[model samples]
Target: MEYTSRHTDGKRINTRSARRPCFLPGRIEGYGTKLQRDIDGKKTWNDFFFHVVAPPAMLDHGVWPDSPTGYRAANEEYCGHMMRLTRALFEHLSLGLGLEKGAMAEAFGGDELVFLQKINFYPPCPQPELTLGVAPHTDMSTLTVLVPNEVQGLQVFRDGHWYDVKHVPDALIVHIGDQIEASMNELEPN
Candidate 1:
């Protein structure tokens, strides 16, 4: 999804909560830069792998406190903003496909479902080879949004060409899924 910088200085408190969706406009840029997960330059692959693996192992019969479920309630600022923006886009896409603005919104039966965000970083390899970040797959959601930080490895086959999405800042990439196709089929043909 698109993002914008929110600047806050150390004196006055900014207390206004986000009530509406925010649209970030920008095109993806650059081609071959590497995305690093080390925000403070202190994290390592060991850190990422351990956390990613440990969560599912704990999800046997009960909910985990530190997983996506916990993150949503605690990260309201990010979650709320994301909810608004996502709902808005879904509405727009619904209308574009000849449905009412809130038509798709009602179909979801309220937004109590868990939202998961995964960031995959692919650093430059010495050979840039003999490694696969993720196996080829299809997204099972209504849409999949991807933002690449640098090195390009994502590819999708369509028609006769393989489309490559290079890394770009503030780029919101959307991949439509089978459910959306079904929705489109229900709309009255114009």
Candidate 2:
């Protein structure tokens, strides 16, 4: 399907959840639709990635796509609102746990250090068991904001089971990584 990065975050970051009502953005009513363009315009899923995904400029960050700023700008635009809420959450996390109001902000230098957005497209497959669209990996940054194309693929490493991340329209996924967890140690305490 033709996946627009703009539409991706817009649709996925807003589902209501009983656990954390504030975790998601605001949901849009009756906006679900099928894939617009074929996953990668290939007759099948395997051919699609070989023909399209492997040759993309995004793969070769040094040569094919020389500009990193473009990626940054696109990410900021897509996740601006989520960033705001997250910042607020962090601020509260710091203070409620006995830190300064802007302590988290100051540690990162009073400005957002980095934000990255990844857009993935997975076409329908007869045997999804044979292959994976994107293999599992941990994000290198402090947090990861994800909006998967559909419901069946995404999973997270929790206590034990591979918990599926259900697509709740307009809801942003904010997962704190190891470093952020460490930073919060003094406050939350392991």
| Ten residues in sequence with the least summed lDDT for candidate 1 | 45-54
lDDT per model, in order?
A: 0.46, 0.47
- In the range 62-144, model 1's lDDT, one tens digit per residue, is 21123444553454465456667667877897688677777765664334433444434343333334434554568766655
Q: Which stretches of model 1 miss by more than 4 angstroms? A: 1-75, 121-128, 187-190
| Most TM-score-accurate candidate | 1
Question: What is the Cα-based lDDT of residue 91 in candidate 2?
Answer: 86
lDDT of 2 by residue, 33-130 (tens): 23222443322222111111121232322211223447434544545665676578668766876778877656653563443334344545555555
Error of 1 at 121 (Å): 4.9
Candidate 1 accuracy as TM-score: 0.54
